[model samples]
Target chain A: MLPELLQGVDTGGLLVIQDSASYSGRHLLQSFINAALNREEAVHVLGFEVSEEELKDGLRGSPVQRLHFHNAYTDPLGWTDHPAFTVHQFCLGELTRLVKQTSHSKPATLVIDSLSWILRHVSTPDVCRTLQQLRKGGAVRSIIGLLHADMHQRGTVGSVCHSATSVITVEPAMRGDEAVAKITKRSKSGKVIQDEEIFRIKDDLTVVVQSKSSKGAKKADSEEQETDPTANLTFNLRLSDTEREAKQKLALPFVFSKEKKTALLHSGPGSGRIHYEPDANDDYDQEDPDDDLDV
Target chain B: MYTELNSILNTTPDSFTQGEFVLLSDRQSDASFLIHHFLSLYLRARCKVCFVGLVQSFNHYSAISQRLGVSLTQAKEKGQLVFLEGQKESLSVLIPQENDTGSQAMDFLRDPSVGLKNLYEFVRSAVSSNGEEGGDGSEEWGPPVLLVDDLSVLLSLGVSAGAVLDFSHYCRAIVCSQLQGNVVMLVRCDGEGEEDEGDDEGSERLMKGLTHQCSLTLHVQGLPTGYCRDIHGQVEVCWRRRQGDGQYTQKKLFQYKVHDKGASFFAPGTSSAVL
Candidate 1:
């Protein structure tokens, strides 16, 4: 899906980017970052799963001035005296305080680099409570959290998904070497739109979404390339319209038709008889001739 | 030779991309041969290798690698290979010795909260690069390749399936994402869904979860007509190379016969009927 279908710049809600071990949602999250930056919404990243250097390296050529990255990766649990935000401080108040102190009244985007890490340490109800509070009332425009589906219990992942306004699941596309974002967007009127689109993160960090129909057309094009025997031949194997009509009209040597059958049954001159003239050299040998030779 | 498999997989040493995740699994027959094949492949590619051998000892792998014409000892001496014997480490972790503070490989045994963090960290630190850009250390090496013999042993050790999956996730972040290396995990799954074994649920969940995430999956299973003198089993290779113009998965099945030195792959029924 493109920007509008992705709920890029809409009213405040929780957008959960759920991923698995196979297809990563990092690039899609980057696309979301671009969307927020396009609107000039202040960006705050809570990166617990990755280092700041890696995050900076990912957005190398992009303008990162408005981007405020919180370093929870260096020491999420306070292993050393590193001056950074710990995973324990991943609460609604802390996030709101960070967003309010950094930007003006314009709603800012809050990204929890991943929700799986918090779900592991924090209780399911607690995380869901924070998600609800952040979405219902705050300066938060859209809260995006990356949740790894395989790392949590089914019931746990389900409960977290229940608290989300949009759940974009990253999965490998069925056709090609591309990844699909299965987005389940719940709009303000409580309408849910489920769509699967093949997406690529451009070098400039823009999401190039390939719709389902175009992907199917591309597949059909490839199959058309392989299966058509008439394609790229030395001789003209196809027939013209008139030639095909003439071929359809031409009858073979078999003289069996309804008129012929009726004429033979009724219009014969007399009784049908077989007349044979046997020559002197033409000797008709019966079964007895072969029987004598066998004995 | 791996020419047949290489052609089937469409992978060569030069084209083997960094940051790829490979999964090897078997339902009926053994798939350890594939792991051995990858070990030989990585060693020949001149990449720094870390092998977390949980199913067998180091000597067993050393012997297998020798048959494949690659010496693990020489690679180890050159600091190009790191081998962690899970059997030995599990033993050491199970039965503590007096003042044996050296081996922290199985520290997850005592600390379930950290899960396989210590083991994952060991893999991350052990295969530290030599002269190249260091990820977690500053030694000397080329691209890092982490190969786990199998992950089911961790499940059998009472570690939760989620924990085992988290271990792989962390490994992917460090080995594949940060370091731009490759991670290969082998898991054993018996049956799925309706025919699910009551106790093998963890391994099954782990395998199913992994299959969804793997860039390439080789599912090895025994022959349907039972064991034959000529054929051992079949391997179904599913290649999901996710970012090229040719993005679809190519799945093909081939039968294999395991000899002492190496194995041979052929189309189904051809190997037994012809050979």
Candidate 2:
């Protein structure tokens, strides 16, 4: 998605990515940085939300030694002993001065991790003015400003969109797991062109631009159905009077029937006593005399 | 001074900690009292304080402190308080041109360009007590608590939203990472009265962005039900806790009330008065 968007980016061109919660701006930024580094173009990242170490960790193992960072998240005094990175005060003036100083070396591609942080401290106009300065500054051929659109006001977003030569909005697809990137506005050499594209992020953190396909949609639908077997099943809630009556008739009783009790024994001939036999047994027991032997 | 408020905040599962940003958003324009209460807590705890006044002047703050039974003069004398008058600068820059006569304009002539950078510089100097003219040796005091009276002043002064955001992010970073102190910023929700949808959206966006950055967000507003007329206002506090790298636990909401002296929190269902 980023490469497709940056295909024709030239000197003095500004690209803005409007991101939402469903989309990660860091991924897009990483991709842009990687692409720039692959071409051996100098890349300077003005990081506000993340530190330099974190940025390096994000681009771990990439051959991006020409990359430099202006970290605003750590070290409030904006002082750093690191050879490749410079810590900057969170002030726009300081940032502008640093950009100018760097531009003196050569025209580089500048990528701001986020503009949302800058917006919180200053007004929209100040941000726009700074971007304008960066664009006109000879040090950078192109500038990419990443903004969390969901975190900013509509007016702020609108103003940023107006300031950029091209605006790319990334959002989550409505039905699929893929993210969708749309080119809402693009201006090339005094000509304004608008195009929309859908894309997704792969596991390797690369953006794959996808074409619109009915087969893809069908596949997604089938996957959805496969995940949920009840996807195609529907139930009716309303029932006719007769059907209701039948359902009521089919209902079981709530209470169970009680069981009858039975007598243990009935009077009969076997129940009669045998008194004479007990008397004879008792006389016999008296003479047994196992109890007589005290020894 | 903020015994009640502190107790209420303490009851939260994730209480406010040092090096955290707390945003106090005023929906009823009564955040000053809460700020005063919190500042009193800081002072009582013997914590050094740096007060950045954006909407109120030094005198106004001093007077409020007096009313709240806090001695601003004593605090300053003891080197416990540092006050930066941002309200003056903000007003000088924000006031309409028609109201700025020759003399008033002359008053601002000596000052450098009024913007977020200057405000940040002022705050930095005010917070750091190193190498200043004072030699009382109180500069070695513990980390100072930061209280920004009104952040909305910057927005009203026409500083860009981006600048304000960046300024806030830096301030938070400084207080949390370098100073290892706590910062409470007061912002007025001015979008309530905005008739333009665009302006409303802009203000909402700004508020949302600030809220997202802060560790705790307390929204103070007038109660919807007039039944409890004795209650001055109500506060809805939301605490955000990071669970892991990209995961965050659900924000916890706490409701409380502002009274004559301090705030009182009600158990979840104790108050039948819907707000």
Candidate 3:
């Protein structure tokens, strides 16, 4: 719906995520690109900060030519490193230059995995200004990312939100020992208050399908293997089956501090299932034998 | 403004692969500054600069002609500057005896013999001649105009205000007749203040008259509260409109600026809508 909401805009729109930690921004961007890019020459994905080895391992068996790939760690000489040192560093001249280059390249889609890191490296005002420059320069059609911050007041979020066409906010909700994801759209006043949905993290990074009737069936998977040639639904091919999984995996280590258990999940191209393990923390206190001895 | 023009001209390559147009608008004084700046750059680039100033007074008219490096008689004869005043009382009484003698020597028709007819004839011939020459002579520069001040002053005195509008129509016609390049017209009026004194009927009449012309109008409203809240508070923007086909379109020939570099626009937050 975020892409549908941004249907008619000419220049690419902005998406700012303020949260400094958690890689939701990256996941959102991957999903947006996967949904938007289709034609052979229409889309280009330039990945910054990650290693070539990591990218190859992750994208194995996937079509890589459709994306104009870059790995900052691997291609250090040509790539612009993630300069998240300070607020000024994020809005560095280097960033502006990169925006100009990307615009000239003329891709239908542009993805900045995490806007939060840019904010961490630069002041809000500067970030806002840099976004204006990118918008004017004619970058891709939509720029989606994760925004993170320790605390974000309504007013602060509203101001930055003005630059964007649509915003979807995600949060972690607890249901017993498992972590559920809740998603909401931003209201007119910039508050995340509409169409709330709780989802379970099933397959590696698969998106939590919101509709109840379609909960069990993977939309892309169902559409891809439709036995009925005259199915009632008109399937959109752009949205891929592995897109949701790729989005989640892109935002690695999706951790929530309040949750008692932390899940570190990893999966590969041919792997049957991803492995999820609980991370231990100091919050759990051991029971003393003298205090409560039952044996 | 001239400094900016000079910088733009110098920095931008003379031969650009993409099309470019220098769109400009400003207040009266600022407009003058801008034209001067543009002319200097045009001259340096081997382009031409043309001026079209309308005058209603003899003394001020002569001064303007002098500043433009042209004599009063030549300006009238060449049809570059139009004298809107009529009759002997229209400053003919003060045409110094020495100038009269000099005018005759220079082949300028007698001031007393000249009427609006002479003015019309000169303009028609000048426009036609530009058309005949193919208008793109190596020495010929881009058509730049400076409408000195408002021509409405003449109409507001005794004639109907419609006369002022008529003058604007005529000016537009002349420019269109020999469209070589861009033309910048400067008009001064009571602006928003005069709108109230005219009453509803009069304002409606003016609006009706204006509706005939196809023009892009930008309303620059000032928000006093934001004057110092950030930096630039005064905002200027071209009003966008939808076409007959129901597609959103932007006016191609306009640009805007906020009063401060740090501010957005001046309109109240509520009345403004975001896309």
Candidate 4:
């Protein structure tokens, strides 16, 4: 998982950054498209390095078809000659157009790869607000944005996170040579509107999926030879002879003097607020609607 | 097997009976092919069955029918035959006019009167004319089945999701109203990408209306990253009452499959029998 730390963050859109060589990234991209089409097709997004042959070979025996959106950084040969606009512009235009055209009655699913780049070109805030509007507009069958994890440090990622319906984090966990697949939920706050709640309840918990490996296995050998709880005639217990030595050490003082208090006042509210619990509801109930205003 | 299909299709054992209509959609090639094959075989002698490819030639239909050694003419005569390609086009796209197809175009679907009558007539003529010639005319089309090759085509072509869902809901309403025939809408979501927040929203909207419109609604998802190639799915059924609180109750149907075979509660694996 290139964005390992982004285990539970849904910055609305996705940010996918992988080693490029790992086919996992490619598979992940394909999964997004597949999810959008309701898994009717094995459609996957074309990456900067993806090839037609690879797509065909990988999607062998799958029903999904590819709908390639234009890319500017790549495919320059076809960029200027084929269409009047660039690839990114075309993709966003098509996406936005799709959102505008779709109906609210039926469901639509939209899957886009790399929101980070999309935002870099268009302002992040615009993308955020546009997504919100599109969702409300009901023109989208569905909308899913993919982003790389590293982009979270950027200010825009935080803004996007606050607006998403749900967020899912996929990452790799390794202990020695063994690997564990961990799926973390970031979109728990998103409302459940379908049959997914049943599946989540029955199957969402992490299972102890054991791999066929024993190199790093640790065995527990403690056994108390009691066959039946009440039938036991005798019991043997081991008592360890432990020794204690008296020792004296200076105790650290937790309290600060007046000088420290003065420094704390100057330090800031963060430290000062930690020392007390203010009544948040104190004036909330007592406030009168007729109270005078500065206006 | 043919007996069961005949019974479900609501056709008399001896009299020529038309097949029921079913719609199956998904992008899993193997799944789409399997569904097509199963429906074709089941509806073979009793009904005409053909899997239409989006990019593949319509002639492929004839070829498939020939290879199966099932007489397409016989199927057509019985009003139990149908084939559809996966191409996405406008409502006005020119549908080829053939003697067999009287008015199955978009206009006909919207109005349904002339087209449905014409369809019934075509079936009657096909069955009465050819079914009498052979001793096998009494054979029922395997089962009435409609297969939608890919549902995403409707979505990608900019078809209103609401419209597609409405059609599905409409089919269910009609089926329930008739109470004799069954309509199955097959939607295949292959992997992780198949599940979208938007689909959930749409499903919620459908559910709001489904209380009175449908007897059952099943959702399935395929998993590519597990010990089991396909994850076991759950089917939730909700029903509405004519009186009382009209509150809905949900029950999960276990052991559903989500994979290349396409997800459905109507059929399990290659078996035509619904369990």
Best by DockQ: 1
- What digit string (tens of lDDT, one per residue) describes model 1 on residues A175-248? 54457777788877989888777776666666777666445668888997788777779998889999999988
TM-score, per-candidate, Cα-based: 0.69, 0.54, 0.29, 0.30
A195-275: candidate 4 lDDT, tens digit per residue: 111001101111223432222232221233334545744764533334112212333367576867797668765554445
Could you give the candidate ranking by TM-score, starting with the highest?
A: 1, 2, 4, 3
CA shift at A187, candidate 2, in angstroms?
15
lDDT of 2: 0.65
lDDT of 2 by residue, B114-198 (tens): 4355556555666666335375565455565788877666566565555566567667766655777778888877655434445
Cα displacement (angstroms), candidate 3, residue A39, comes to 5.5
Reference-based lDDT, each prediction: 0.76, 0.65, 0.37, 0.37
Candidates, DockQ: 0.17, 0.11, 0.01, 0.01
Tens digits of per-residue lDDT for model 4, B195-223:
33344343332222222233333333332
Tell me model 3's lDDT, rounded to 2 decimals.
Answer: 0.37
What would the per-residue lDDT of candidate 1 be over residues B1-275, giving only the tens digit for each residue?
A: 37568777766767677777899999866899999999988888888999999899899999989998999999887778888988888778889878776568787776665677678668867755445443545456568899998998888777887778767866766677767888889988766442464766778778855764567889899888888888989998877543454333567899998888888899887875665
In candidate 2 the C-alpha lDDT for residue A20 amounts to 62
How well is each residue in B132-233 modelled by candidate 3, as lDDT tens digits?
345444233334232323323233333333433333333334443224332333333333442344433332222223222212222223344434333322
Please give me the DockQ of candidate 3 compared with the native complex.
Answer: 0.01
RMSD (Cα, Å) for all candidates, in order, is: 9.9, 19.1, 30.9, 31.0
Score residue B55 of candidate 3 by CA lDDT. Answer: 30
TM-score of chain A of each: 0.72, 0.62, 0.47, 0.45
| TM-score for the B chain of model 1 | 0.90
